[model samples]
Structure formats: structure tokens, C-alpha cells
Target: MRYAKFSMDDPFISMAEVRALVEGEVHFLAGVALLPDGREKIASRSSTVKVSGKLLSASHDPKEVNEAIRGRCFSIYPDVILGRDKNMFRALYSEATKGVETSKRCPKLDLVFTDGVIVAGIREEERDSKSLREHSMKPFSQSGTMDPFTSRLMVNLARVRKRVLDPFVGVGSILLESAWMGLDCVGVDVDPSMVTKAKANLSHFNYQCHVIQGSVTSLNLVGGFHVVTDPPYGRSSSAKGATLRELYAAFLSVSAELMERGGRLVFASDSREDWRDEIRSAGLKTVSTHLIYLHKSLSRAIYVVERG
Candidate 1:
């Protein structure tokens, strides 16, 4: 399990979200070239299964990355992202916990390090750098949002071939994240604007995706997903004006359809509604639950759920 753990780029919150995103796995780490949409990012979509052939994984602890890739040829470079401050080189070095200095001119990372310490740097053409800028994002935009949190999740989804579904695909944020991570994402949304917005957002990054304007209860979902997680806002969307009992029933049905046998199903929802019965009816068992503060109005709960 050499998967990488991507840290949530939220300055206000700690790396706990990132830790949960990878389920305590670390292999590699890279700060995004961009800061994501300047809005609140719930989670950093990450690749859970670390594929050896592709040679990439999720890692949050810089020490873990340093220890794992110590003897191997490595390069630590920041993406020449547009919106982020040029000072990210320092922050990334700090996160890597390595006292390394990189210039602003170089974009693609190409270098070699000794004991997590940078010995020398190289240009894009230098070293064994396989310069593949095929997925470069378009100009920065404040129109849609995607912080490091969602991006990490998307990458993890790219690592496997499974039913990738998002129940509450508001503007297809997670879908965009998954697409970049190299996975085919299917998004279900009730709002047509969200579908359009998702397409626009995906187009901004020059990505192709599948978006469905529909409800979660009866989603056009085909197969089971490898990892299914979404920030369900009852107070705002699906749960609005409905009783807890009614909401849970709806969630149970949708959740069940989203997962396959032994598929990892993680969902974040407000605790205002009871989940005891829904957990059972959905044929999913609770693994862990954490209290999260999603602003003041909504109470956030991250539940590690699995289909049994």
C-alpha cells in the first residue's frame, strides 16, 4: 500500500482531514500548483491503492515520503500554478521538513536529494524527468471551486477501475477531482445548473466527465464504487424540510446503490439527524465517526462506512 496522502490545503484547519482522506496511508506528497478555488474545501480526494507501475501515491507526512523514497532517485519541485503565492516553495520545503531552496523559474520538478536533503536541482529536461504536462489546467478562475482537499480524493479515484459515484455532486467538484486523478467519474445532481457548472469547471481544466442531472434516491448509477464519499448537506439540500426519518431512508437507498461488495463508503453529513437505523438498512457498518465543524450552522460528521 504505497499510496500517497494529500494534505488538505486549508490554512484554518489542520491536516486531520488529509489523514482521514488516506485512511492513515502515506507514500508521496505534493502541494498543488494552485490553491484551489478560494473557498472552503471539504476533503482532498486521494488515491487509496498505490499502483507501482504508475509510480505515484498519497503522502501527508513529509518524513514518511523522505523515508520511503530515500534511496531512490527523487525530485521535489512546486508546480508553476497561477493563483498561489510564489512563496509555496518555502512552505513545501517546510512540509517536506527538508531545508531545500528552489528557484521560481523552474516549473516541472527535476532533482536529486540525499537523506531528504536537496543536493542539486535540474531543469525539466534534466535527469529522468518525464515531462508530461498533458493535464495542465486552464487560466485560474473564481467561478467554480476545488481546493487541495477534493483534488487529493480525485487522484485516489484515478488509481483503480471501479464504480466511482458522488451522490451529492454539487457542480461536480469531486468529479473534477476524480477526472484529474485519472478516473472516470459519474456525478448525480438534481440541479441542471450544477451539471452545467460542473461541465464548465471540468472544461476549465480541460477534462472530460459524465454528469447526470438527477436525484440521489434514484440515481442512474451502474456499478459499485471503490470509494464513495460526499459532503451531504441536509440543511441546505437533500435534507431540507424533511424529517430525520425520511432523510435517512433516502440516504440508505442511495448509499447502498453507490457501493459494491466490500467497497469503501465514506460519507460526511450533519449529525442533526440520527443514523443508527440508516446505517443498518443501508447494509453498511460504521467504522469511525468524527465531529467536524462545518461553519456554525451545520454540524459535520465524517463516517467510515463499509458495505457488508
Candidate 2:
């Protein structure tokens, strides 16, 4: 689909990270909505600009240096990058004059990815080619889940018109993500510590959340909830009482009972075993599975499960 990308408005923001995620120009221009590692809040969005220059005069004149530099080379961007401010250019140009041959540096308006053009904000070698998926065993800051991850999750919910639920609502990762995205969220967890943490985090972010401290099994939920969770993985579990297998089984059983006719569950989990087939047999239909890393053995499996 040839969608027009709008650059974020903040001329000084960093476009290095977001640029690597998608193939081309950004959906929004100027200020890009950025989701850094472990960030709950996707910060103000920023646009990207790649500038190239050559030292001149004494190999120092801005005009001569600028003239000698490759013009269209700006289009040949690095796979990994950042967009600097125009004000930042002065110091940069000054630095280059001092016998420092900077291949690429400084911010310029003429050079940018606008109108849906896919530019290399970062070069291939700089990017981690392993498919990157944003996740958290615990939710960020609490309120609204407005990052790229939550945005995508909400779209699925809205498209299916299915009420979303997060069974392992640690600090409200999934629920908070869904709620602020304008989807109804139902969260469950046995840990009182998590429930409170989730609530506090939600309040701090100023986003709304509907969470229960009861187990998903006994909740006897009404209506239907599409489950989505980031279950505790490895040493990240605050679930001191149960094994990883038991936690997953609870999720499997809950999906069988609470999900409506077309409900879905999208969650991240640590594998003690292949859980995809287990979830399917538990009355949920498997959709797609994406593998993501959350540190070491905590390799997360992002599952999209739908009710049969």
C-alpha cells in the first residue's frame, strides 16, 4: 500500500530508531513518535535529515567545502541515524574545518525524507536485522499505551470490534496499551503487588484502566475479552507461587472460557515448551506467531490467538 508518510514536525528530533523499523519515509513528518528501549511513553515524534559536506578554502570555507561535497549523496543515507538541529550545524561545520573530515553530520532542511519516500536513516550494518518487537514484562509508566506496539494492537482490536483483555496485566502493559488507544481493556493477575503497580502506573500516565486482582480462571467474565499479555519470563516473574507451565495453562483455560465467538489473544511469553499448539488445543485458533527477544532465554513468542 502506497500510503503517504507525514514527517514529524520537530526538526531536531531523532529519526535513527524509527527509520530502521519501517522501510521508507515515516507515516508522520517532523516530530516522530519514538519508542525507545523500555520506554512506556512514545516521546514526541521527530523527522530525519542526512547531510554531507566537504572541507574547503583552507579546506575550511563553508562555501567551497559545501560546493565540493556530493550533492545527491544525501539521498544515499546510512541505515542507522539521527537528525540534528539547524543550529547544530554551526558547531558541526566548525568542527569539520578543524582537519576533521566528517563523512556525514549536521542538520539541513533541503535534505529529508518527505512525501512517503523511504530513506535510509541508518545504514544496514548499524541496524539489528533481527525482527524487533517492542514488549515489557511490566507495563510502562501506566496511563496510556500510545507507542507503536500498542497502536498496532489496538488496530486489530478495533478492526475485529473485539473487546481486548490482558490476563497477566503486570503494571497494565497490554490493558494500558489498549485503553488509551480507545479499546476496552480487561486485565487479570493473581499478584496483588502487580495489580497495585499496574494501577499506579496507569494513574501516573493519566490513562484509564479496568483491572481486577482476581485470577482469570475464577473471574467468570461476562461479555468477551480478546486476551493480550506479556507474561512474566525467566527471573522477571513476580509470580513466586506458580511454575511457568502453570501460568500458561491458566491462560489457555481462560481463553477457552472467556473469549467470545471471534475474540483474539495477542501476548508475549517465555517458552518452557512450545505454547502455540497448547493454546490452539485449548479452544483458541492460532493466527500468527512472531519471535522477539526480551534479553536472553527470555526470548518472547508474540502469539496472536483467536477463539474458534
| Per-prediction TM-score to the true structure, in the order listed | 0.53, 0.51
As a whole number from 0 to 100, the lDDT of residue 227 in candidate 1 is 50
Q: What is the C-alpha lDDT of each candidate?
A: 0.47, 0.47
lDDT of 1: 0.47
Task: Report the C-alpha lDDT of model 2 over 129-178, residue by residue, as the tens digit.
Answer: 11113323334444332233432433343233447777777666555556
Off by over 4 Å in 1: 1-146, 150-161, 227-232, 236-245, 271-274, 296-299
After superposing candidate 2 on the true structure, give the runs of residues whose Cα lies further than 4 Å from its correct spot: 1-162, 235-243
164-263 in candidate 1: lDDT tens per residue?
7766666655666567656767777777877777677678777777777877666656666755446445444445566646665686667776677776
